[model samples]
Target chain A: MSAADDEIAPLPSGLEEARSAFVALCGGVGGAKLASGLQHHLQDRLSLIVNVGDDFDHLGLRICPDIDTVLYTLSSLNDQFRGWGRARETWNFMHALGQFGGDTWFQLGDLDLALHVVRTHRLGSGETLSAITADIAASLSIPARIIPATDDRLRTKVVTPGQTLDFQRYFVEQQCRPRVEALRFEGADRATVSTGAESSFADDTLAGIVICPSNPYLSVDPILAIPRLRQLLRDRSVPAVAVSPIIGGKAIKGPTTKIMQELGVACTAASIAKHYEGLVDGLIIDEADAEEAEGTSLPTLVTKTLMVDPRSRNELASRTLEFIQRLGGARRIGPQ
Target chain B: MSAADDEIAPLPSGLEEARSAFVALCGGVGGAKLASGLQHHLQDRLSLIVNVGDDFDHLGLRICPDIDTVLYTLSSLNDQFRGWGRARETWNFMHALGQFGGDTWFQLGDLDLALHVVRTHRLGSGETLSAITADIAASLSIPARIIPATDDRLRTKVVTPGQTLDFQRYFVEQQCRPRVEALRFEGADRATVSTGAESSFADDTLAGIVICPSNPYLSVDPILAIPRLRQLLRDRSVPAVAVSPIIGGKAIKGPTTKIMQELGVACTAASIAKHYEGLVDGLIIDEADAEEAEGTSLPTLVTKTLMVDPRSRNELASRTLEFIQRLGGARRIGPQ
Candidate 1:
């Protein structure tokens, strides 16, 4: 057993007869962390529906940051210290790109390019993004079912005060420098849930949904913006819990808090709860935000939610799963 | 003046008024060497119409081997010592490709990928190969018109005794081990010369056509196989001269002599002249094959053609241009 497995509670007694399958929604780095913990905790039974809002064609190759992050994280290839990409990755491609005066703003590592190349080729050959993502997961020996939110081109267009920007342009190229006004999922209205994702959530064996600590407006909201996907999630009878991305009025990573403040919302755990208020059955806030958890619209689980290490990640995942089990029982389901 | 200038006779009195413009046809490595010499010697007055038969899409990126070789060679970026690709290049991309279990037959350097990425993007955007190549040349400040023989998809498919293979699959992946039966230019029947290549050849100040020491049957032949391109060269009134790839019954680089021997042709300067019999007005052979030039079908220029260094390459290029000028005076146009 991994060090992470030691912290996770064993499958709840009656459910031990059959391993429970779960569907977790996630975005990039922050979401990948919690999704990784759940992957380690639940192993084969977990399905991670990653957001496709951040997907972009850079230098002619389709790059899916969130799905790639989940794949790299679960496969133990992610660079934790650098906060992105594969460990021990070389930046020769980027350096050489600079030599040619090609776009160097978006960093592409030599090792990272292999996945992009393969994905680009397969996509060019008419394979769907989700299929390519799953094949890559299988190639990396990642056991969990990693799914893209939708196969269609549902790009996140950040409508800042000055202009609209592609997700990568706003997040990476501009370093999230723009003031947020509103966000748009370019193709979300027409897009349906990816092939197996909706069914995975609707399955009889589905225990619950864990909306990981990804940015609500930028990350998780794009996936939910797909009308059918949102309707399907809303229609599901099982308990859906969200681990608050905000803790003590700050996001763990990325532009979540900044974007929230720009959108004129209070950058606190309570606002995060309110953001996903109608979708989730309960909210899991960090111990730092336990005081802010008062008078919440939904049932709350306050725990040590900062997943700094493998042990902490597992502990938080175990506590959240345990909380889900308790909520699946007597707690009245409120918002759909 | 360069050391090669010592052997190069001054431009004749009448021709000294205006520096002449020349159109040279070439392929990879060996061709690049001589093309570089002419580019240095002629500066802006040279047009290098590179063979496009070797172009292929690998890892979803359009790679024009001969055109890239020309670009890298003229820009002083080509890896002369290692044979192909850019200098001071890193193979981290290939290593990572190996890690992903990607195709490892054809080697792609990290620096090289930048060009491929940019080209692939441009090509996907509906721009022709010639346009992309010229644009890249401009980006690198390559002065000569680095034109592809044709922008159309005219691939060189090697027909070995066993089976037909793509140019790269035959040359790189298989290491040219397959015994040649015949080679096929897949789209030669319908392909036309690139937009500006024909006009460059037919210009008023056009001096001559120099066929560099690239493999005649493989590299140069594919360009000639393009019906319009061959007809255009045939229709040209100016002297068309060739430097024999063979010197002392051996090719300087690649499988020229081997393919010649396999194709049931004698590997001699005389045989090279015979191959280009109807097309070229003169043949330039090395000192080693001076005896083989005796009673050859075409006018022959015997010189020190072993271009082992910069001076020697320049010397050969200067000598060939002088031979073209000399041939332009005394020779009667025989083949059309």
Candidate 2:
């Protein structure tokens, strides 16, 4: 599609009714896509509570992979081909860093380095990640709120067949080469849900919670691992739903299916429903996986969730909103 | 002069001289110019022992302004117009930092951020600034050794008319507008000279110490303030000579004269000589200030110290070497 054509596209009609407040638990690329789609449909009604376990300090800058991906994708600044970072990026800084024998496993572009630099500066100056993310997203003119799951430092570690590796090492550097044995969130036990997450839970206008199609073991679990987070979600009266990341026994992107298979679980929508068993009241599976959704105890809806183009994204977002409304939830779209 | 013509200029005779070891005490811009000239003239023989009192953490990156300037200048990569940082630089990172409400007075360039990133990473990994500098300089094809005077944190504070401010605050943010009352090196008394400095002092074939024409108050004093540094220079049999940063009651660059006046000094070449009276065995003054040479206690040599062009730089470097030889010092030239 031409750039100009994409810019002036009209909003989907489903978004007109998606006025209810939402808190989404998200990962990086896969999750970012869904989060972006939801923001397009619901705008300010969406609040993305991103995973901080994927955060790592590389080249002395704190990189929140999932958080930045979500922020960039929502702001329409993300590089489409790369799935992360900004479009039209330059690597002059990375080339120079390589000359100095610095860590180059995780590539950082010149424009993207500005994000890390600003975030690192704010973190050092004693600002919480939540506050910093809000300020940064606002500067980019992103209408939806983006926040970390918690303010405290939480690292996701994967126990592979050979060794325990940090999230980035396993996901980016190693490219998910090792077979998964287990997973754990290092600081989740002590991490408190950020005030934004807390307020989202307390808000009477909240319609439902949407768990984006992020990696179950590596992404969503970290948010759920926070001691009181799951209990808080359970206490809320609003409907909570999750979209299955796996379709036709394969993940749309990343290592969701790989990790699930390594862990000896059936990689399907049924498995996703079972994984989020107590947390979510509904499940959304792609139409391709409709036959596999019959056995799930929770109410399930089928839609085309591929999101290959803007039309598909808007369509899936509209379908999801309609499903939420069928569950007795009313959307509260924000001011134009 | 055309850039091409500047490159075809003849090398000085002293450029072929080999020496076992050479040491220089340097500051920011003014000192960096002489150090660059020395590096050009002496190449591998030069060892720069830079003062770290001006070093500070800005935006979480350790910024050693003098050391970076000297390194960039010696590598022929310095931004001549800016007087510091790398040439052909971009301000994207600094602009982003300003957008995030960060302290933006320092003007860190995009390419310059790479150095800070690498240095900060290495330092955090337990590498000393000396080792990191060596790595960076070596990568840039710079043959000289660059060492920080001390590894411990030492800060230069200017006691202005009203309050004492950090070196960057006084020099950069406030544009050096504050009247100086006194200047002090905060951690100098407790800082031990780095191993690089001590080894240069103990080298059997050590030549004369060159005090580059950096500001005496802000640039060179911190190096001298380190415990036993002055005594080591005084006890050495080799001639320790200083080049005057001021001529005709004005500094060649920076606030050397203003600072001297604020402290009630005459701001003359003789005053510069007297400032380093016991530390220096000889003083090199500009031909314009030849009238004041007879009044100084130390043996003085008058030469063209202005390094407006490569020829002037080479001439001053050759004359300084000739003066060292005529002072009856040991002949320490040629390949080690």
Candidate 3:
């Protein structure tokens, strides 16, 4: 194995204690980055249960922004400069759309459009998004398994001060300008947790569940909103840890901090912990906020949460696995 | 005015000619070339009615290939190399799609996708294809008015030796390799011709009709298949001429000749002339196929039919106008 692969090797000490799978819940951008980091460490043992709340119909195409972001990021094809979409993307299609007087508010690059096209075609043919996404990720040779939180439609509707708008309209077209009042997953009442995700949780060999650092209300909530998903997570007799999206009262990316304030929540790690309170057994917060971690009820691990480089990601991932091992009551079987 | 424009000006000399409008029925590629030629000469005076038979649900986006081709070609945005879609296009979206195991067979370039996305969105929101097309054309500043044959669903299904497939499947996915036994326009029986086209036909100020050298069955037939459209043409007191797609007993492009033979029709100018016997008042054949014109019952005119360059397109178009004048017809006055 290469030096990079050697560094990415599963913790021998933790593995000897108990071999367990890791399921990460994620959204777009911020979540995707952390998911990529986790995938780097866990490799084939990672199961990504991505949120579909941001999925919306645009120009007759069922566009799953979060799913696509995670998929592209995991495959290392994500446009890091843009922080979303595939690397080396082009906007020629969007330019023509402008010429045609079509809506160009939400820019879809050429490479990015292919995913929407294929997914839309499959969905139109009655194939579930979960199945199609699996095929797409598999085709890309992504070692980690990416699955939708649910097959049923669960649109994230942001109820702002004046009106409720579709997620994209709020996030993309409107540029998240509206003051958030409440957020709701429209189809969550009817949504069942994807069978694959449920199976992962039920599997006896399941190791750990890591909630990737995504927007709590906008990303993670939608996945948890699926009627039985929270119950399943609560019932799972395995270590579940959440990586805090906020550090020092600010979101690492997106409008998470702003939205938190607008919704009358303090933009702090405490707020994040309060949100995922009942679901997680442990919380991974940045070392910068370690001084404030003592007050939290959950078992806390202070680590460098920011994934600025590959080393940082691997270091955080290793610490997270080690913390899970200690919390699971597994005996450490190797040298530190 | 230019010398050629002066000679072909609307209302030439003293002649009690029948009032007719120059209408061209078209599909994509080959049809768009002729349509572009006619538009260049006739300007707003030409009504280019495009076939909607090939429009299909691709990746949940409503893709109207013929209408888009005509629109793109007239606007000078068509990619010459691909013979369809926009010029200066990028395949970033398509390449990304391949990575995701998408149905890359029907390549939707990034720039090309914008049109589909916008059209599909507008269509889903209850906008008619005619209105959307008009908006698109006007945005592109196209001089000629391009209209879809119908606002209702009308798909061309090609019945190959093994099975019947949609037009895109036969033309794109199957690479037109399927030996066509028959072709049917699904939903054509209930489809109504677009109001814009119907109004153009009903207008008493029409000059003369010119059928572009597109495939008679695949392109023109679908337009004629609309209920009351053929009858409307038959009852019109105007000269209607058809420019034969066949040149020296073969199609200039596409499957016209092959489909003709499969359907047990002779793949010749005589056969094309016979197919439009009652509807067309005259027939235009290439100079190379002048020998075959003797057997046709309609008044025949010979000219170089190939439009490889702008000069060739204009020359053919000019000859077609002159033929209409000789047959005792005059161009209409006013903007169209």
Judged by lDDT, which candidate is best?
1
Please provide, for model 2 over B171-216, each residue's C-alpha lDDT reduced to its tens digit, 9 standing for 90 to 100.
8899889999999999999988888888888887777788989898
DockQ of 1: 0.60
Interface DockQ per candidate: 0.60, 0.52, 0.69
> After superposition, which runs of candidate 1 have C-alpha atoms over 4 Å from their true positions?
A1-17, A331-336, B1-17, B332-336
Clashing pairs in 2: A19-A331, A19-A332, A19-A333, A20-A332, B18-B334
**Alpha carbon lDDT of each predicted model:** 0.86, 0.82, 0.82
**Which candidate, 1 or 3, has the higher lDDT?**
1
Model 3 docking grade: medium
Q: What share of the true interface contacts does each candidate keep?
A: 0.65, 0.57, 0.96
Candidate 3 lDDT over A289-332, as tens digits, reads 88869877788898888876555666677777788877776423
The model with the greatest DockQ is 3
Q: For each candidate, give the interface RMSD after superposing the true interface residues on Cα.
A: 1.5, 1.8, 1.7
Backbone steric clashes in candidate 1, count: 0
What lDDT score is found at residue A63 in candidate 1? 93
* Chain B TM-scores of the candidates: 0.95, 0.92, 0.91
